[model samples]
Target: MRAIKKVKKFIERSPNSTEGITFAKLILALESENEFPVIELYQLNSDEFDLAIELLKDWRIDCFYVGKAKAFDSATRAKNLS
Candidate 1:
C-alpha cells in the first residue's frame, strides 16, 4: 500500500507533533479527493498512530475512524441489547 507507506513516512518524518494537525490534514486531503487507498492506509496504523485521535474525537469529519468505529459499534450493540 503506497498510501500507507506515505503516511508512515510522514509520521516517521514528524514523530513529535503533539498537535495532530498534520495527521488531520493528511486524512482530510485523502478524503477530499475520495482516496480510499490513502484512508485505509491510515486506518491500519490508527491505534498507535498519533495525537490525531484526540483531535478527531469530536470532529464531524468522516476521516477519523480510529476511535469512531468502536464508539459506533458499541452504540449499535447497546441498542440491540436494549
Candidate 2:
C-alpha cells in the first residue's frame, strides 16, 4: 500500500517529470505487449527506478487476479443463463 501510494504521488505530483514520463511510457509499452521501455528507466535515479519496477510487478499481479475473477464471474453467469 505504501508503494502504491508512492507511485500515485510520483505520477500525480509531476506528470511531466522525467521519472513520470518514463513510467508512463513503460506502462504504455506493457499494455502494447512490446519490449519494456528499458532505456527510459535510465531517466530515474536508482531508488525511483526500482520503485517503478516493483510497482509494475505488483500492478501486473493485481491485474491478473482481477481478470481471472471477471472471467470466473462471466462463466458463472453464462452457466446460469443456460
Candidate 3:
C-alpha cells in the first residue's frame, strides 16, 4: 500500500513516468501475488497505454482513458492493429 501510494505520488510529480513505472510495478505485483491489481494509471497515450493494457488485460488490470482521440485514432489506423 505504501509503495502504491509512492508510485501515485511519483506519477503526479512526473506524469511522463507512467509507462516505465507502470510496467515495472505491474511485473512486481504479478510476481508477488500471481495476479494483477485493479487500478487505473492515467497519463499514457492510447497506443502506448494500450500496449500495456493488452499485456495485462487477462490478468484483470484495468488501464482506463489515457490518450487524445486524434492521436489514438491516427496510431490505430497507421498500425492497422485496432
Q: Which candidate is the best by TM-score?
A: 2
Model 1 alpha-carbon drift over 4 Å, by segment: 1-3, 7-63
Clashes of each: 0, 0, 0
- Model 1, 49-80: lDDT tens digits are 44344334434444566569989999999999
Order the candidates by TM-score, highest first — what do you get? 2, 3, 1
What residue pairs are clashing in model 1?
none
**Model 3: lDDT to the true structure:** 0.56
Highest lDDT among the candidates is held by which one? Answer: 2
Clashing pairs in 2: none
List model 3 lDDT by residue over 17-82, tens digit each.
656667666657755755554454455566646655555564443223333666788888989963
In model 2, the runs with Cα more than 4 Å from the true position are 31-35
TM-score per candidate: 0.28, 0.74, 0.37
Instruction: List model 2 lDDT by residue over 3-79, tens digit each.
Output: 55787777888899888777777667767878875777766899998898787887788789989999999999999
Q: Distance (Å) between predicted and true CA of 20, model 2?
A: 1.8
